[model samples]
Target: MTSVSSPLQRLADALRKDTVGGFLLISAAVLALVLANSPAAGAYNAVREFVIGPSAPLHLDLSIGTWAADGLLAVFFFIVGAELKQEFVHGELRNPRRAVLPIVAAIGGMVVPALLFVAFNLAHPDKIGGWGIPMATDIAFALAVLAIVGRGLPPALRTFLLTLAIVDDLGAITVIAVFYTDDLSFLYLIGAVVLLAVFGYLQQGRGLAGALDRSALPNWVVYVPLAVVIWAFMHESGVHATIAGVAMGMLMRSSTRDGEHESPLHHAEHMLRPWAMGLALPIFALFSAGVSFSGFGTMLTDTVSLGIIVGLILGKLIGILGSAWLTTKLTAAELNPSLAWSDITGMSLLAGIGFTVSLLISELAYPAGTVLEHAKGGVLLASFTASVLASGILLRRSAHYRKKGVPAETAGRE
Candidate 1:
């Protein structure tokens, strides 16, 4: 059967074409490491440590690293929010039955790694907070790797990974909001909610329903200021600021109207995605990935580092594979005939490439000191290790398919 074009297919194609963003992210990370270890280390440290933003009335003064984590990353989260909404509305997740495998795999991927991290840090109560670090799967990095090495694999594999990673992100965002946050300001949170409602009302075409197209509301004129207000309120309310993006994005209506096939959500995502993937994420990686190598050698013996590494490498592999296996056995579900066990294994390892969100969680979980440095190092190391392992497996599978005279285009038929 010939493959029909769908939202998931389009997403897979878009991801495969985003080679530039993937390369930029990796290059920026490498540049950070090189600068951190070279003679320019002092300048790098000063720039990252320098405080910026308002100090008095706004109380917004924050280090460069904090701005990267809390501010720029929100753009990335906005795209993620839109992707999640789209998936639930029009993609694979729209049907619960079709979505079960990835949902089960995502849960397994998150839970097992967290438990493994906790197991390693059980003796050290101080390090318990870092358990969330290993639970995230950086979809950008994973998709980049998949796009490069999995050309011969079925398109279903890419969709599976994308769905799983998006769910994993939802879990990560929930953890940040509930467990990582400290103190509470219900008033500010309520204010944020009100602003969000106003934003939704405008974007959803409520009062101005037939008066004007939703896109007619200039983003700079109405949306940007409202988003900033919500973000500020979220920050002040002791909730993670990135959550504002998620809440606002979900509040947007995803339905088509007024002879327009695309919703405002799709329009916003289309406008913002290039910047989020190409610049915002790379800048965040540049600021956050500059861990000093002074303690690199000692990370091997460090309990927190060991836990993060093992949790990502071993726990993700076991959890995802085992969950998928169990799901197939317990129900009438079966693996796609076009794919082999090796394909799943490679995808599982790729799921362990938790670079972006993992680093962000590391900063939140551990104080800025030796323990934190070790955790960051572990994240970098584990992601690299996973990339290498996954590359080998996927490449081998590609060659196997080639020898059988299977064309790469055939994969899209799924």
Candidate 2:
């Protein structure tokens, strides 16, 4: 056999790499930015506006771009759901005591951000509803930042931060399902359950201990049937359809310790990661992140805009830092392993970077309007600043460890 060309090697290589998610996500964001700012911006709008006719047999309608939110995001959620289950069972959140710090931190991170948003908007009662805007941490974006600057931090410390972000994502998904659902239809849910149950039974027959055994949710099965069922039902139900992603993901099995083929979780994550990041997310970003900056002068003054800004910045800082300290104090839970107070503080700041999830909440809260744009701007500004500061601190900490010959794995969780 002939050796592959370098370019082909890169493409084939990305197909299975863990960092592939980051590559796809960043590329999409970049593409979105270019199209939005380029002379061909009208083309970008046109693509999103394109329609995908007849979702159900009844010929219910959906738009091409909107479909990403309703359809593809569900797959994304499924992978996330599977990951959450795995974490609860075997990963960083493996035990309750071990899980407490991140959970407390996540709770604080969410609550504090919302309160800050409320603080900004409470004076204007109409803006009160947007309090949830700051309550999420975009795991992909958060991890990307960490990966970029993560070398400065010890491996264990970096892993801890990533784990916290993942746990935080689970909370965001719950909030999306519980608080963000628009309309409910029990009949559709019944249809979804039947489909999922069929999926579960078929897979359960294989007798894997956990479902996250592969890159996609199910090792031996295709998710299309289950996804179609969930999409239809979730669309009909009050919940955001992306919740279907988490649901479908939870159905799969787990990977073996030696990283053998097709653990359900790995299989699921593999299948969804690129589509979520590359195709679906790019489609999503072009539509969702496409706020017209030219309207800033008039729009910035809107109470909604101001509220989103305040909520993300102040809220995230208080929620993340305060919660960690309080949890340690009350539970006497240990702080992360081998981490000094300074390092913990630095990582806490990184938790404030709220790009991906903030955008999602904005979409859920406002769909399309000045409010969404304002929230996007707020996320970009605050998360950027926080990430920069956090990077500097974390980088310095890494240098200290390097000089002292400290190993990264020593950075422990309580």
Candidate 3:
């Protein structure tokens, strides 16, 4: 890894990142949305909803939800958690000073959305439980947008957004654990902690370098089984199942400025994305996105779910825009130069694309009835609106930046 090879390797890695993995993910997401809106939607729903395996036969019981949540999502979180740890340890976010912009933005983003959601619920106190529905960042779509633009923005902008989204997820995970527990089950929680600690020790030792190499493709294997154990413990221990994603991601691996492409840990993260996207996310989305249009007209007027709608759309704009403005105003550091205040504002609006988080919160808060149905509507509307608006703004801004001779994407300020 000489300095000479490093730059070439990075460029190669970036190209690899975009071509294979990126293409697969984008294809999956696009296919999902299209299929959802297509006449074949019924078939899509049936496939995702279908439960497989025997009833305690060999005790290998699993549902559509179980495979997605317990199986594939575990891998997604494991990768995210690994990235989170790496950033803190060695990436751009290694220093508090470097991290402040995105950190403050993330905090404000989380806080304002939650407050707005709570306000919506409070106005119709019956729905107050649905407060956490508007608190997530859809990283894939965001990254895909950056990739699509091709030029005009600096690389730093994408990096900043990526870091911010990861932090935002960390916060959302915390909210789920604190607000959404079904039971104390202290004993189960204890089991989770013990499992967590065992993984921690393994990670600290780099999970016995050689054993990992022989068993897995690379020598740094620790994240996968550890994530599985954590999921089992976390689920049985009274925590929402997905918290396992958050927890495992946090403790998965040490960061490597060395760029451990062959490291088993990194290898696992790479391998897992397809499973998470092609399998887990699509499965989850298929099951969750179906909203019966029965009495559909009246549901729109219903305040509880409608409030969810207003809160997400309105709240996302305010929090993301206002906080970003405040950060620029109060600090010497500025927005990515290729991006205007307008661009950031538009991106903020897109931050309202709160589909996954909203769905998870809805699951925790209201498991039944028209209110949940409404909340579903609210998420769809808000996310759809936010994504379109953000995309529009980004395209417009990219044009402006290009006129001034900036790359459309890739974060080059000069």
Candidate 1 lDDT by residue in tens digits, 83-165: 77777787656666557877898899999999999999999999999999999998767876787777667666777887788
Q: Which 10-residue span in candidate 2 carries the lowest summed lDDT?
A: 205-214
Residue 60 displacement in candidate 2 (angstroms)? 6.3
lDDT tens digits by residue: candidate 2, 154-255: 554555565677667767766776777655567777777787776666555345533433445653455565567667776676555665666666666564
Q: Model 3 residue 202 lDDT?
A: 59
Candidate 1 to truth, TM: 0.83
lDDT of 2: 0.65
Model 2 misplaced stretches (Cα beyond 4 Å):
2-10, 15-20, 57-60, 152-181, 206-223, 255-262, 267-287, 298-303, 338-347, 355-357, 360-373, 398-405, 412-414
lDDT to native, each model? 0.81, 0.65, 0.64
Best by TM-score: 1
